[model samples]
Target: MLDMFRYNWQVRQDWFEWCRELPQERTGGMGSILATLFHVANGEQIWINSMQGTPVIVKEGVTSLEEAVEFTELTQSITEQFLQSWDDELAMKTLIKKRRDGSEITFTYDKIIKHLIAHEIHHIGQLSIWSREIGRKPVSSDLIFRDY
Candidate 1:
């Protein structure tokens, strides 16, 4: 589990760096670069909050890439802290979350961890596509590229 979290964090850091390097034209869009980063960071927070059974509030209004990077780093740090404090019993327990569309779902800590990584990968893929469409060089996303 710790390995998974570390790997996820590394990949997220790579994406954040790529976002930071995006030119102003590439970063400008419906939600813009900052907004996309906020959405990604908020998604991580939502998963953590759901697992902890805390009140989940959607975050908004991030205006700068630097702000997004700061928020992402902070949230990742908290996630790492929580994982460090996790016990076997807690990891095996299930968390129930109520969706905004009035649906309820249950997941264990292990499932949440996997979901968090997978969800980020999905979004990063989207970002890569957009970057390619805009003629910007996309960062290497394969895990092997980061293995060194």
Candidate 2:
């Protein structure tokens, strides 16, 4: 699971680099590249807050990829610290969250990590589509032959 987390982090970094070649503005109403990247970074932060039972404060006005990268690195550092002391017993523990409609959802710590990873990959698919629309090749999503 830790390996998966590390791999996703590298994949995100590669995507950010690929996005740097594109214009900062939106091409076809899909969304601006840098804005989408910010969304991904913010998603990690929201999830970290959820895991820590803290407030989920959404940031705004991050219009540059460099700013997005900074936010991502900060959130990743917090996640890394959390994982460093993780154990199987904690992974088995579940967190229950109440929805606005008064419904409840439960997730294991391990599953939360998996969900965050999948969330990033799903957005990467969106980035890939927008990249193709703009006549650019996206970073490869392949896991094979990766350095980490």
* Residue 71 error, candidate 2, Å: 0.4
Candidate 1 lDDT for residue 121: 73
- Backbone collision count in every prediction? 0, 0
Scanning candidate 1 in windows of ten residues, the lowest lDDT window is 25-34
**Could you say which candidate leads in lDDT?**
2
Q: Which residue window of length 10 is worst by lDDT in model 2? A: 22-31
Give the Å shift of residue 23 in candidate 1.
2.8
Model 2 clash pairs?
none
TM-score top scorer: 2
Q: How much does each candidate deviate from the true structure in C-alpha RMSD?
A: 2.8, 2.1
Q: After superposition, how far is residue 51 of candidate 1 from its true place, in Å?
A: 2.4
Residues 3-83 of candidate 1 have per-residue lDDT tens digits of 666766676677678876766725533366556657767888888877776666556657777777788887877677778
